[model samples]
Target chain A: MTEALASAATEDILREAAAWRDAGRGVALATVVTTWGSSPRPVGSQLAVDQGGRMIGSVSGGCIEGAVVKEAQDVIADGRPRLLDFGVTNEQAWEVGLACGGKVQVYVERVE
Target chain B: MKRDLLDSLMQAQRRGTTCAMLRDLKTGGQGLYINGEFTGDFASGPNLKPLVLKAISEDVSGRLPEPYQDIFVQVFNPPVRLIVVGAVHIAQALAPMAAMAGYGVTVIDPRRAFATDQRFPGVTLLNEWPDDGLEALKPDRRTAVVTLTHDPKLDDAALSVALKSQCFYIGCLGSRKTHQARLNRLTRMGFGEADLARIHGPVGLPIGALTPAEIAVSTLAQITQVRRAKPAAPQSAAA
Candidate 1:
């Protein structure tokens, strides 16, 4: 694990906003639209990652955040909104930090 | 629309006030309405605002205790506060933690040298005596006061205000012996034993902490426990 403990998910979201502002890029907000079983983050949990590789917010238990961040940067670059879904099967869920067979669907859109 | 209302609610929370956010959860995507204003993308009828406001006022005043009251009202505007009656190392640690936990932290100490914005950045530092500062604070159910001075004059003065007010958590940093002494003195000063019981002495949880930072973490854990017990509402405020 990294030496730094994970920050409050809220901080992650705002940092993304600042990054967008700093880099003169539009922002895309991603939110957890659905969830099932024991999940660290609840529905409506949001992460707004910008094109400048800076992020603020979290959607998974530190599992899907990196993936979400990547998609967010792409959304910023393309200026097209998309709904990215993850955590369907058991194996898929395990890859994204969802243990205990919990699946969460995240909706990512570029809403500047 | 949801974002706008949430931002307004968070603004009120940052100022240590309560606000109501109404969300129509029946639909697939919720519509957030704040203070009777149709702030969402989809507009409902005009009368919805009055109805939601009535519901919110009643819920905040405790006239309604329905199961979803927490979701409907409290989470929309969570209480964020910091009551520090002393300027010490423990207060140094506690102030920042409280801020990190989304509290609008305020520090009170008569010693101007001890309490300064430089010592505790991003916190409101009051260079007034505890009693004077607390009187201005008007601690309510959302406020959390912690005393680290171990000086009776400062602790007692603030405790009097905190116990009478609606503050939920009252903690004084002291050992077992000091706590007993505090209780005895407060009892003599006309405070009931029950009131004394409300104050958490030895301050934090029994985490065997020694340093100021560690102790701050333990105190934060205890404070979070109280916060979780009273899940305010589900509205997010912008920092």
Candidate 2:
């Protein structure tokens, strides 16, 4: 069931990214390429962001989505992909509402 | 090129066709595979082809192999369908729950009053006969057919059609005695014991369910159990 929801969400992100690019709005996609310990979302999860900060989907279930969206803006602007690592400390985990410590690797790329 | 791939993918999804999209992160290349046939051109070399096929067969989405670490495979299958061949109380309870579980539900009954929009809102209501309705719906492997009407006229017709199809689940609501009678009737109609074995008579898991909603839960639970069970070896006709 989780896989089904994640698959559907990824499809939605791809479709929205395509739509945004077609409308001449620069688009970038952030994908969770790897995760260690108790991550909310699994690998292959995606979040799509447009130039104006409009977003669809989630890579870390709101824990690091804000940061990913921020980096996605840069990727869209420069058309250069970058990998981001988020290793949350216990205090940071509490602040971000994650249940425990974990690390997530997200790859952000301009959707061409 | 991306637009064309997106268009084809959207069309395949709308048509409920099984497909997979493979995207290479390193090169930004994309390939679309629909029903085992490749459509768009992408660098899915021989090394990664089997993995893609395995992903499609399992209906799962994940990253590719070590050499193709950057590539991701996303699989899309048709939505599961549930066809309830009666507008009984159990149908009323089951339809909504099935819908909540992401099934496209259709409630069929020739009796107009029982099968009403007021009773089953947001469900596809069919006012035709059981055989005709099942014929039109064309229950596939992703479909589950349940007969709640105890009447031989209705349940038998629906069972005849459902048993012939590749539907993953076929459950008929009845007591043990009633099911025995049903088995005898079907046997008289030329159905063998193997085909009869597929019908989950006295349907639903034995959870001491006494209410309509509880029975619906049990039925859905049993259906989910069968769906998630590992596939067994194919039975030969002579077996």
Candidate 3:
């Protein structure tokens, strides 16, 4: 299931990337490298964060979207990529609304 | 990607197969992209378009696995389907317009003369009674059934079946008075008030659509909106 969802997610990112490239708009890709605790989606989930921080997919439910968006925009601005993680416990998860306790590690990268 | 699966999907689509395409949206390689009837790798360069076109057009055979298959299906899958139960002029215009809007259109009418290929050129023409046809068609969550016949016999069967099943959208062509009368009939037949409410009588988005073509467009637009609108956020955003 992870592989299938990732595959489609990747396709969507690539397709969007192509569209952005064709339109001459900068884009970046973010992947969920790892996850912990109760989460809606699993690891390998991705969110294609564009230069404008407009997302094309999701990495975690809404738990880490804001953080991911910030990271994506930073990646686009820096023209470099970085990996980030979030929600290791109730305190950190409180901001993202993860039930019980859960966490996610995301890898944000810019692709040509 | 599995060649056989792609073939099955395309073949089903060409033959108007009624099934949902479940796309996996979280995986792919280097630069693979998928649009309806097209799947190509960014690394492959210019050759990708031709490859995808050829693959969709020809009787290709393969089984798609995990992410790639899901993406292929999502990009190519027919989301909401419009099954028009009448062969009116409105259907003629609506069928093509709906197709253009990415809907898998099926026009069903017992009148062979009315529901001809000429009338709905590119549509999946089914010359059968609405009820019988719908029974065989089996309306699912992704299916939307519309009754333009305005005739009780034809429209009622569809409404009955649609009300019983999980069909997402069910609309009938009628005026306020006609709709009330239809609702009364449905009530008499033991349809609950809640069930009767599902019918979108006076179909179409109150866009002041007058002509048959205009009405068709209005109906299609409303269906599209209903299909794409995201579900409201519940208490939890876990998944």
Candidate 4:
């Protein structure tokens, strides 16, 4: 069931990215390419962001969407893809909100 | 001209066809593969073809081989469907639950009063006879069919059609005696014991369900169990 939802989300991300590009809005896509330990979302899960910071779908359930969206804005601006790593840090665990103690690698690229 | 890969993929999804999209990370090339053929223009060579086929067959998405490590293959499969024959009380409950579980549900009953939009909101309602409705739906391997109308005139036709199709689950609501009689009838209709065994008559897990909603839960649970059961697992041995 989670897989099905992820697949649907991937499709939605692609559709939304294409629509944003067609409408002349800068678009970038962030995909969960790899994860270690108890990541909330699985690999292939995606989150799409347009120039105006409008977003759809998710790479992490909730722990790091804000961070991804923040980075996605940079990817859309510079047109340079970025690889982001998020994990629990002793002092920053509370700040990152990743209490589950897992690491996630996200690949954010401009959809051009 | 670069073809719109997303548009093509959306079309394939709407048409219920299995397809895969492969993307190269380094070079940013993309290709759409469908029905054993590659349609879009991409730079990945023939070496990655087998991996694409494997991904589609497994219905999974992941990175490619060593040389193509940067590439990603994403698979798309049609949505699962559930067909409930007989707009009985159980159907009213099961349809919504199945829909919530991501199944496209269709309720069929010849009785107009029973098969109504009011009774089955947001479900596809067919006031046609069972056999005709099943024929039209053409239940496939991704489909689950449940017959709740105890009347053989309705259930027998639904069962016959579902049994012959590739539907993953087929259940009929009845008691043990009624199921035995149903098996006898189906046997007379030339269905072998092996074929009849595929059915879960006296449908639903024996959870001591007393109400319509509880029965619906049991039925849906049994269907999900059958749907996800690993075929290689020994069934009788587990029992």
**Candidate 3: where is the Cα deviation over 4 Å?**
A1-112, B1-79, B231-239
| Model 2 Cα lDDT, one tens digit per residue, B143-237 | 89999998999999999999899998999999999999999999999999889999998999999998999999999999988986558888897
Residues B136-239 of candidate 3: C-alpha lDDT, one tens digit per residue: 88888768888998889989977888888888898899999999999999999899999988888899999999999899988987786776555776787677
What DockQ does each listed candidate score?
0.15, 0.22, 0.03, 0.27
TM-score, every prediction: 0.73, 0.72, 0.52, 0.77
- Kindly indicate the candidate among 1 and 2 with the higher lDDT: 2
How accurate locally is residue B137 in candidate 1, as Cα lDDT from 0 to 100? 85
TM-score of 1: 0.73
TM-score of chain B of each: 0.76, 0.82, 0.69, 0.83
Top candidate by TM-score: 4
* Count of backbone collisions in candidate 2: 0
TM-score, chain B, model 3, is 0.69
Backbone collisions counted per model: 12, 0, 23, 0
Error in Å for residue B107 of model 1? 1.0
lDDT of 4 at B27: 64
Candidate achieving higher TM-score, 1 or 4: 4
Which has the better TM-score: candidate 1, or candidate 2?
1
True-vs-predicted CA distance for residue A92, candidate 4, Å: 8.6
The digit string of per-residue lDDT tens for model 3 on A19-50 reads 67557666776766555666666544557666
User: B72 in model 3: Cα distance from truth in Å?
Assistant: 12
